[model samples]
Target: MFLRIFNRCASTATASRPTSFTFPQRLNRSPTAILESLNSCVQTDGGNPAYIFMDDPFLIPTSGHEKRQLALSKAS
Candidate 1:
């Protein structure tokens, strides 16, 4: 169920652009934590293949520091 929705949303995403998707529940985790989890999920050896196949990475910034970091990363 979750995968279907996520796949549909992810399919429309492009690697060269920034897109946003909102989940049902608010996330309580930190941006770094979320990124780490996603990073692990995309790994080839021990990861969710569904995420590995995503065209672009997901970025969820939940704090000012994370927002700034994301902006800087994109700028460079």
Candidate 2:
């Protein structure tokens, strides 16, 4: 979660600040509201693992359906 910006100030006055320096980049200040955002696409699928075709009932995770949901929200 880090961004590196490399710039060469042409003069000493530019490097030294008399006023506050705003970051040339913006950071995502919002923490994930849920743990599902970090998981793979499959984990968030909302389906019954028990009745599903999968053999190991617990092999697949059935949780939040927000994997692509978040992407669409960001687009708007």
* Candidate with the greatest lDDT versus the true structure: 1
Candidate 1 structure lDDT: 0.65
For residues 1-76, what per-residue lDDT tens digits would candidate 1 score against the true structure?
Answer: 9999998778767554657777798768876997898888884765333332343456555467766776677669
What tens-digit string does per-residue lDDT give for candidate 2 at 32-66? 63445555444644644433325454444344454
Q: Could you say which candidate leads in TM-score?
A: 1
lDDT of 2: 0.48
Off by over 4 Å in 1: 1-58
Separate clash counts for every candidate: 0, 0
